[model samples]
Target: MENSLNSIFISLYAQRIQVLFAVIGVTITCLVLYCYRKRKPGICGNLRFSKVAYNSITVDWDRACYTTHYRVFLRKPLEGEKWRSFKTKNDTCSFTIKNLPINTNFVFSVCACNGTVQGPLCKESEVISTQNLAFKMKGISILREETLPNYIPVYDVPFRVERNGQLKVRKVTIGDYPKGGAHQVKSILFVSIPHSGHTTHLQGVMNFIFGVSTKDDFRLGFSSDITKKSDEYKNWATVYQFVEYEGGRLDKPLTLVDIPRMHGPKKEQLMMIHEQLKYILELYEQRLDCICFVGPANSNNLSPEEIDFLESIMYLFPNDQSSDLSTDISCFFTFADAGPACLENGLKSSSVKNFKSYFVNWSAFFRETNEFSDSFWNMNIKSLDNFFNHLNASKPKTLRLTLEGEPPAPQKKENVWKLQPEVKEDVANLQMTKTNGENFIDNKTKLTYNLQFFVYNGGNQTN
Candidate 1:
């Protein structure tokens, strides 16, 4: 009886031990599943470098669900350096790494973390090279008046073309207008930097708008070979007049003034061109419809000369209080060979108020077809049609011709011609004193008065 009782006790103990073991196994499995659930969020997605500077970079990534935070790891792949880690808060999606070496290639990866559990790392980002800070430091240095000897107002010097002969002005009647009919008038000024293909583009514009071939029109007086004598082209501002008609009735009479390239060897010559342009506009006695700047579509940034030209335009045509009188500024880009990125960069870098830019890939299209081909002419017509349509839809502001006493402040004094209304009386008084042979004012004041008056009166000789 004692043996049987011991066996029963052993059997009961064995069954109890088996049950305890099963419970322990189930508890371990449950713990494992819980730990896995905490780490199942995911690695960050779409990791990219948002901004890159000389010594710093900003990395951004999409947020993951159930993520408490993100950890970014950066390293120089070329140097085989150990990764440097940075942690961000749960709401943060971007991290900026600073004090990094410039002009170095960098790669980065990001991972998500839920409290203590970390998720898998994302695919590494493409290598990005930091910028060279030295290029940013280099800037255009301006020469001061004191640095130049015998510095005189640029307007005091006559244009080489004016001295050689009367500047050529051509007029043509375009459109189908019935004789003895009233017509509206519109004027546009075209300005550009050197080597921007301004003349060719202007010829295309004239052909498109007026259906007149300006290429061989001797009356237009455009340089026969601008490439061979670019310097001569810069010495004169070619002017043209086009009278428009619609349905046998007179319409807008368009005056297209092709200003000389705003860049040249002598700063004085550039200023002279600017002043002469102002004089020409004053003679119009009407507001300009647009001042279009022609440039290459591949340009990513404006040169110092281009910037100066833009600032001069702002001074010449200030924003009037009336919306109707505000000058419409536009940029025309020719030969879009570099693609949209360059165009976007150009627009972003332009300092003009109304950032309207138009472009045509004429060079590219022409390369595939002959000049006499229908497609070549159609392309030019279509591009210009779109540009004009946009201009009409936008209700381009009219540019007032009268020079204001004060213009928008300029970065360089040489870029603008400042005038005061009181100067008119002062100039009259100075002239009277000079006639009387009396020293009414000091030489410095007398010269200032004469210079200011000279520019104020459209660079004309005052009586």
Candidate 2:
């Protein structure tokens, strides 16, 4: 009797457990179907934006629980630009119409969904049109002027060491071969610009200074930082720093060569740099063979005479915003040829009276039948080797005008024409050339460039 009773109890308990599990599974299935069928109608929450456009507000939707994508529609509130939509086979719930012109009224709607079904859009999100709305742009970042063409050099600054503990150069953050020289010191300038070239030169210097000779000493500068501008300069040459401080970063010299014309920098920036060099040069004894200016070579900022004095060191690197720092400053006021390296045998650029500015048409492309491509002109100095014999800082001006573009009007016959308000070049400027071969000194006292402006239409003979 006891055995029979025990068997009946165990069977009843097993049946109850099975029924309980069955009920729980059904409940879960019901919930899954409810969520799937809910179509997940995303929240528009009445489209919102930082600002309203014309009469419309932006649309926003929730992307939660979405598998595939979303869709956006714009309407004229009634018959607008015809339900225009953005395809979103993927998941997205937000869309912005950035160029929605000003002073227009429009309505926009958006919705999101799973691959199986789409949830209904809640409240058209936001209706937007930029009518009567005050269009105020957000704050924009103003880049430092250093970011411009006058690129600053990269740096690998040693903890500003001193001869007797006097800091010769400030701790900072810091290119190429070139013409005309003496003593054959086998000197290669590792230069630095205020912003660009310094890093490269520093790296070059470090490798040589701590290379095989001090192979084990490499661990010292292990903590020293070097950028590309400084890396190329290691050990090959001495470095000097001239920049003081501009917003904490070094304030490298400004040059006219990069600016090209008065449009380059404000009249004040020229004076600022002129005064800067005047003061900076005072720190050093005029001795180094080359005062490697690792900076831009354009004469738009510096005068022809000023640049000649700077190059009085050696190798006459056309651009060396990257000044050097070395104990031995021996060579001073020596001339190594500083003209265009590629232009040695022939003229590279021909001036054209085409645009208001003197259009320098390079001969390498025109004469060689080389099709000019944008990428070609963007190359470094080596890429430009075929065209420059080294840029002639004091080359005589010959207006080589192309017969293309607008028809040549005959009213202009002067060799140099004054620039008009519409154009950037000043054609009326006098043609100034350097006198006294290697010792050209600028007595102008003013930090201004005399652009040898010329009239393209008329020959110099008439002007």
Best by lDDT: 1
In model 2, which range of ten residues has the least summed lDDT? 327-336
Q: Can you tell me which runs of candidate 2 are displaced by over 4 Å? A: 1-8, 31-43, 49-59, 62-70, 74-80, 86-107, 112-142, 145-463
Q: Global lDDT of each model?
A: 0.58, 0.32
For candidate 1, the lDDT comes to 0.58
Clashing pairs in 1: none
Candidate 1 lDDT tens digits, 1-463: 9999999999999999999999999999999767765766676889888887667899999988667788989888865589889888664889998888645788999988877778889999999876542211111111222322322111110111222234422233333343566555566778787667886686456445433321311111122332246544546666565453321111355667776555455345545555556555654553566778777777666765666566565556555664221355677777753356364354343345465667654452212234443444455566677767655555433344444343343344432222233346659988997866655444668789899999999999967
lDDT, residue 197, candidate 1: 81
TM-score of 2: 0.23
TM-score of each: 0.42, 0.23
lDDT of 2 at 64: 51
Q: Report how far off residue 169 is in candidate 2 (Å).
A: 38
- The clash tally of candidate 2 reads 111
What clash count goes with each model?
0, 111
Can you write out model 2's per-residue Cα lDDT over 356-393, one digit (the tens) per residue? 11112221211122344222222222222221222212
